[model samples]
Target: MQIPVINRSRHALPEYQTAHAAGLDVRANLAAPVTLGPLQRALIPTGLFLEIPVGYEMQVRPRSGLAYKHGIGLVNSPGTIDADYRGELQVLLVNLSDQAFVVQDGERIAQLVVARHEVVAWQPVEALSETGRGAGGYGSTGSA
Candidate 1:
């Protein structure tokens, strides 16, 4: 599953930290530190461009350590990058804590997961097939 990528940042290419990890750790590429106040969000650049396959997509996800320790997370959790896009990968991050969080250069900020997708054609029908819980949504099943 090798994909073509251009690393324009100062950091090394993204890699899986663990053997069984599904996502690669993406780093931040910045000239200086960018601080985000409580509830403030910013688009942090990665300086990475990818030539993703036509049937594949890249997903930007949040690191659990950052979310649990510093209360920082991605605004668009699992931000999708279509295969056709050839732009810098920027992470939309928000400070969810009461303090300000500084984004340093070459800091690990997010995760990148490349996955294959299916292109479905318009199958216009009168109604969808019935199920045991048809139309059940938003906690309709049960509470945790």
Candidate 2:
């Protein structure tokens, strides 16, 4: 699936790192480094704009290494970018660790996954059908 994109930053275009990777790595487009103190959050710009197709959306997710090592992650995990949006792609990152984290220009800060979705129509049913574990949630099932 081809999507139209505009890149205003000096960094290279986002791409998948491996053969079967589901997400493409996205970089930060900062002129200088941005430091995030512990528990602090910032909206990092990508300088990228896209025209996603109808019925499709882009998901912005955190990099595992950054999240595990530096406690750097997206404030809204798996953030959804609607197909109609035509603005610059910005990532909301937060430093969850005790120490500060610095985001540099061209650094792979997040990942983007393009996905297709379906719009559901409400049936307005009076009640839902029963299941083997009806109404069971959050540890209701055994760990096994």
Candidate 3:
């Protein structure tokens, strides 16, 4: 699926690193480095504006390498970008480690995944069908 995008940054547009990659890596569009102290978070801009099609949304996710190596992660994991939004794409990054982490210009900070969604209509009812494990929630099943 081809998407209409406007890139104002000097860096190239976000692309898949591998042939089978599900998400495209997005870079930071900063003039200078931004340092994030431990447990600190910042909204970093990507200088990218996209026009997502209706019935679809863009998901902003964290890079596994950055999270594993530097404890850098997205404050809102898998942030949803609605199809109607026509603003600059920004990532909410946080430092989970004790040391400070610096985000450089054109650095790959997050990823974007375009997915289709369905709008559900609520059917108000008093009773519902029963299940084998009714109301079973967190840790309801035995640990294997």
Candidate 4:
């Protein structure tokens, strides 16, 4: 699919991949750098402002290699960017490891997947349809 991407600065739109075999990484621009502390907290910045189309959203997710290597991850896994929002994308990162981490400019912080969704309007009802494991939540099923 041809997604319309805009670059306000001279920096290029985030490429999905390089010549490397791994998936492409999203990066911060030259202006911002995200810092992760031993406390496992980071303030991630959205390199560019986006205008996503309606019915679709951009999901911000962690890179597996980074997660495995550095123990750094997005605080809100699969963070959601609504279509109606035209703002900077900020990622809250948590460093699961014992050391500090730094996100450099043009470094891939996470992957963004543009996805389509259906919004449902809620209506109050007295009862809901039953399911196989009705109301059984929070590890109701055995963890093998």
lDDT of 3 at 29: 99
lDDT of each: 0.94, 0.96, 0.96, 0.75
What is the per-residue lDDT of model 2 for residues 1-144, given as tens digits with 9 covering 90 to 100?
999999999989899999999999999999999999999999999999999999999999999999999999999999999999999999999999999999999999999999999999978988999997788889977754
Q: Write the per-residue lDDT of candidate 1 for residues 12-58, one digit (tens) a residue.
A: 99999999999999999999999999999999999899889999999
Q: Model 2, stretches more than 4 Å misplaced? A: none
- Between prediction 2 and prediction 4, the one with superior lDDT is 2
Q: Write the per-residue lDDT of candidate 4 for residues 1-144, one digit (tens) a residue.
A: 565555554456766675653333567664756668776676666556777888988888898888999998888898888887777777777888888888877677788888889999999999999987788889987754
- Which runs of model 1 end up more than 4 angstroms from their true locations? none
RMSD to true structure for each model, in Å? 1.6, 1.3, 1.2, 3.2
Error at 123, model 2, angstroms: 0.8
